[model samples]
Target: MDLKGKTIAILATNGFEQSELEVPRDRLKQAGATVHVISPTAGEIKGWDKKDWGRPVTVDKTLDQVSSSDYDALVLPGGQINPDLLRLEPRALSFIKEVFNAKKVVAAVCHAPWLLIETGIAKGRKMTSYKSIKTDVINAGAAWEDSAVVVDQGIITSRNPGDLEAFSAKIIEEVKEGRHVQRNAA
Candidate 1:
C-alpha cells in the first residue's frame, strides 16, 4: 500500500470513537500516507471509549482552516455523539460534499455513515454500518449490508470496531486506486 503522496483527512469532533480514529490513523500512516486530524474545534478533541470518555487527540486543523481539496481522502469516525454533532454543522457537511464531488475516497465506519447520509451521498451507495443505523442508511437511499466492510465507488464503510482490521485494509486499497470516476453526485 504505497501511499507516499497521499493525504487523508480524519474528520471528527468530541466523542469520536477512540479506536476508530487512532487505529486507522496509525495504519494509514504506516502505509505511508499523511493523516491529518481535522476537527470542528482546535486545540484537542475528547474521544469516547466503550462507555466513558477516552483520551484526547490533538487537532491538526479546524474545519475553517482547510478545504476538502487539500486531502486525497476523507475519513469519518463514528461514535454516537461525534456523528450526531457533525450532522448539524454546515461546514462539515460542505467539506464532505466537496470531497465526494472531487471523486475522492470517503470512508466511514460504524455510525459514521450518518455523516454520509447528511451529505446526501448515501443514496444508492452500497455500504455497511453499525447495525443500529442500518435502517437509517437504507432510508438515505443506500443499500445496506451486514458485512464487515463494503466499498462502492469510492465510498467505504464497515460495521464497527470489530471490523476495523478489514476497514483499514479496504481504505488503503481504495486510496491506492485513487479517484473513482463512476461516482455520481448525490
Candidate 2:
C-alpha cells in the first residue's frame, strides 16, 4: 500500500519525544507520504530523550501557516513539555478541533493526548496515554485503557515510546480507511 500523494502533519514543539516523532515520520515517509513537522516555533525544535535533551528536528511549517485541510492526518508526539505547552496555544488547539471535526485521523502518543483534552474532543472516546495522565484522560471523558495502542473513531493513541511500532501502524491503517464521520461535535 503506497501513500504516494498523502500528506501527514506532525504537530509538536520543543521537548517532544524524539522517537515518537521520528519513527512514525520515517515510517510514513517510507510508505510514500509527505511528512511535515509543524510547530508554533520557527526553525527547529529540540527533542526530549529519556531523562536528557535530544536532537533538534527541523520544523517544516509553522502552525499559523497550515490547516487541517492541508493534510490527511495529524500526529502528536508526547513529552511532558511539548503537549503541555501546545495545549495552551489557541491556534494549536483550534487546529486540533478542526482536524477532529473533519474526521481526519488524529494520532497521539503518551502525553500528547493532553492536547486532545484541551480541544474538548476526547470526551466519550476510548484512548490510552502514559500512566501518569490516566486520570487526566479519564476526567476529560475518554475511556482510558492501558494498552500498547488504541484507536477510537479516528483518534489513535499509544502508551509511550515503547508502543511506537503499534502506534504508527494504527495511524497508517486509519489514514488508509479515510474519514470517520460518526464522532460527536467537539
Candidate 3:
C-alpha cells in the first residue's frame, strides 16, 4: 500500500529482537512511509539475535524529543530484554497511551505485547504474541489467539519472527485505514 508522507514510530531499546525491528522498519520505509526508530536512549540501542547480540539500531528520536501526535502509528519490536526495560519506563508507557488514546494504530510482535499490558491497553483486545507469553497476554485481559497476526481496533499483534512479514503488512494496512475507534481505551 502507498504510505507516502506518513510517519511511523518504532519504539525500542537495547536487547530488542534484531529482525523484529529491522524487518518491519525496512518494510515500512520501502512502502514509502517515513519511519523513525524512537528509543529511551539516544544514539543507538542493541538488538538481540536468536542466540547472541545482533546489530544496533539508531534511535531517530529520543523519548523526550517527540510526542504521540508526531506519529501516525507506533510499533513495538519485542525481545526478552527490550520490552522488559521499556514497560517500567513511565515516559515510554505514557507516550504509548497517548498514541493509543488518539486512536492511532499500534503494532506489537513476539513478546512486545508486554508493553501493551503494562500500559493497561491490552485489556479486552484480541491479540496474539510469542507462545511463551500466551498466559501473560490472557492475564492482561486480551482474548488471545494463535494466529500469525491479529488486529483488534487498530492494535496489531503477531506471534514471532516467522510472522514478521504479515505483522509489517498489517501495520501498513491499518495505518492506511486511518484511526480506529478504540473500543477499550485505557
| TM-score against native, each model | 0.98, 0.98, 0.98
Alpha carbon lDDT at 67, candidate 1: 89
Better of 1 and 2 by lDDT: 1
lDDT of 2 at 163: 88
Clashing pairs in 3: none
What is the C-alpha lDDT profile of model 2 across 1-186, one tens digit per residue?
477889999999999999999999998998889999999989999999999999999999998999899999999999899999998899999888888898899999999999989988889999999999999999999999989999998899899998898888888888888999787778
Q: Which residue ranges in model 1 land beyond 4 Å of their true spot?
A: none
Separately for all candidates shown, the number of backbone clashes (residues 3 or more apart, or on different chains) is: 1, 0, 0
Query: In model 2, which residue pairs have backbone atoms overlapping below 3 Å?
Result: none
Error of 2 at 62 (Å): 0.4
lDDT of 2 at 40: 94
lDDT of 1 at 118: 92
